[model samples]
Target: MSTYDFAVIGAGISGASVAFELQAEARVVLIEAESQPGYHSTGRSAALYTPNFGPPIVRRVNAVGRAFFEAPPDGFAEAPLLSPRGALTLFKSGNEGELAAFLTNGTERDPIHPIPVAEALRLAPLIRPEMVAAAAFEPGVTDMDVAAIHQGFLRGFRRRGGDIRRAQPVTALRRDGATWRVTAGGEEISVATVVNAAGAWGDAVARLAGARPVGLVPKRRTALVIDGPADLDLHGMPLVEFAGDAPYLKPDGGRVMASLADETPVEPQDIQPDDLDVATLVEWLETHTKTSVRKAPRTWAGLRSFVADANPVVGFDPELTGFFWLIGQGGYGIMMAPTLARIAAALATGGNVPADAAAAGVNAADLSPTRFRF
Candidate 1:
């Protein structure tokens, strides 16, 4: 039997990163159900780095994460993981409250500021002149090279002597005498601790381990790439979004990537894009912008898993021995990966939040799995 200090399930960005952080200090193994790591949300992410995007704690994590992305560990990645891309949010007549709500949560450190509709039109030329009333522009928003980030963590983990078990679906988890026997694929692994970074299948993994489900609801988000206006230069265009629950558009080369911004709750499974969602997005684009979906576009859907409070469920379970929760990252996982990974590693290895992360506004107690129990 191969024995280790910890077994991290799900080799997405979360698992790969935490494993990278923990392996140097203790023996660690990363077990992935899929043949390829980051096959789900991590792979499907639009990979935008918007500091003002997530909830409060997540925004804080984003602040802390910026340093790591700015200057990653030596040899972590060859090229930069972030590229400059601005985001512009348009508020039609009734959605001014939504814009206000966004500003209230943002800190002064963020580069987001209100702009006039004319400026929004100047920044993003496609918006219909009569459709927008006000705007908010955040110049700090960037495009993340998610694949590079995911692969870098994985490579670092393996280089640091962490074992990897791919194509291994965890079927059973049994604990005996301070050791967990994780049966996945055809073999069993003995480890002192288990970290559930299973993304959308998080609650299902918890149930298999005899731990209480943490109410992880997987929400589907559909995105499509469509040909847009041909005359304008879309390359330098900012991400244009409506203030409320409307579709958003981002320039993709000469094309545009559009999403209905739908958050439909569903059971965890291999998700597919709904036709209605794609159709709705097309309608929204035509109504809100000067662009039209001229042909059948490439489309896909991915699940963003979240708990009731919509923050990540990190830290160890209060009721389960040696079982830690690193799930429920939702749509902010990519942006929060660095800070969250460090936090998870620190907590798993007999420490609290790192000083930098703490200063950046991460409260350990708030992310504890104990919250879900009560």
Candidate 2:
């Protein structure tokens, strides 16, 4: 039986970040079920960073994560992970109340601004003139270099003496005194600590360790790629979003990618696109934009796992002595990865959690897995 100081299950951004952070201090092994790393939702993210995208807590995480994208560590990446890209939120007529609420909620960091109809179209040429009533723009949005960032983490982790094992899914786990005996790839691997960063399969991992589920739910989200005009110049284009997040569009190479923002509850598995979802997204785009998308070039789907309260589950499990919960990141995992990894690493290594995080009400008990028992 091989022994490791820490065994991180899941090689997505969350697990990768955690393994990398713990490499210098512990002998860590990163296990991924897929043939390749990030074969699931991590590689299929929207690939953009917007500070004002989600709720207040998510926004705070994004704010702290922006630092890593702005300046990555040496030898991790050659170029910056963030590129300038704006975002425009569109509101239909007679929905002045939602617009006011959005503006009020987004003006905290001065990143969101109310823009007139003409200005909205000027920023994103795809917006229809008559359909647009009013809009808000945030020039601070940036296109996230997800591939580079993932590679950076992998490179750093491996260089720091961390091992990454792909296609080694943990099938059974049990606590043996102070260590865990994990069975994966027909072998028994023992570890003093286990980090449950298994994304959609978080609950299953916990169950393997005889721990209770944390109510983590995996929701399906679909995306479709439509062909754009042959001579389309997508430069200076902002991510155009409909009010209440009904549907949205973003530039993808020479094509345009659109989504219905559907959140269908699903099990943890390899997800595929729904044809009806693609058709609905195209129809929605036709109603909001002038671009006539008859059919899409490609369509795909992935799961964005979340808990009952929609907050990320970090820190250790109160019930399981050596088990850590780093799941339920939802759609904001990529944007908040840096901060989340740092906090998880700190808690795992018995280091002091940041004062800012504590000030933001990041109590250990609050993120414990037992919170769901009550």
Q: Estimated TM-score per prediction? A: 0.96, 0.95
* Residue-level lDDT tens digits of model 2 in 23-51: 97899999998877889999888888987
Clashing pairs in 2: none
Off by over 4 Å in 1: 94-105
lDDT of each: 0.89, 0.84
- Poorest stretch of ten by lDDT in candidate 1: 102-111
| Candidate of highest lDDT | 1
Error of 1 at 77 (Å): 1.1
**Model 1 quality (TM-score):** 0.96
Model 2 per-residue lDDT at 108: 55
Error of 2 at 199 (Å): 0.2
Off by over 4 Å in 2: 108-110, 359-361
